[model samples]
Target: MSTNAAFRLQDAGFSRAQVEALGEFLDSQAATKTDLIEAKTELKAEIAEVKTELKAGIAAVRTELKAEIAEAKADIIKWMFGTIVAQTALIIAAVKLLH
Candidate 1:
């Protein structure tokens, strides 16, 4: 507390001793600049750790999705080829019967 504040408190009916004790108590309970900085640093570290874990998880999921998509594409190609061959055989048999 500044001298001005102490003087104001005295004018407002607070004793010198009372004002001094109040200032001391308030200061003790308040957080310092260093305390806030330390808390901020710790929070940043925790956030970075979480971010790294998320990135690794996303990469693993991406790999799995790619594998699944490739397998699906292979199955589709096989089915398409089989359908085309079967269609061609039916068309040829129909033309011979019609003649």
Candidate 2:
């Protein structure tokens, strides 16, 4: 608090002891401008770090999903080829019977 302000408070029906107590209360409860700025900077840095980690995690999941999808596609293709061969062999046997 400034000298003028302190005097003003005293003139406005505040006791000197009351003004001193008010100053102490405000000092204890309020952060300085420098303290607030530093806190904001630290919070921003932590947020940026979390964002980087989250991106890495998402990319890893995407890669795993792609690999799984490729494996499933290969399994489906193998099953299809097996079914085709089986059907062709059955047709050949039926034709031989007719002959």
Candidate with top lDDT is 1
- Locate the minimum summed-lDDT window of 10 residues in model 1: 1-10
Q: Estimate, for each residue in 1-99, the C-alpha lDDT of model 2 and write its tens digit.
A: 778888999999999999999888877889989999999999999999999999999999999999999999999999999999999999999999999
**Which regions of candidate 2 deviate over 4 angstroms?**
1-15
Query: What are the models' TM-scores?
Result: 0.80, 0.74
Model 2 / residue 69 / CA error / Å:
1.1
- Candidate 2, overall lDDT? 0.95
Candidate 1 RMSD computed on C-alpha atoms after optimal superposition onto the true structure: 1.9
Q: Candidate 1 on 16-54: residue-level lDDT in tens? A: 899999889988988999999999999999999999999
RMSD each, Å: 1.9, 3.2
Itemize residue pairs with steric clashes in candidate 2.
none
Each model's lDDT comes to 0.96, 0.95
- How many residue pairs in model 1 have overlapping backbones? 0
TM-score for candidate 2, residues paired by index: 0.74
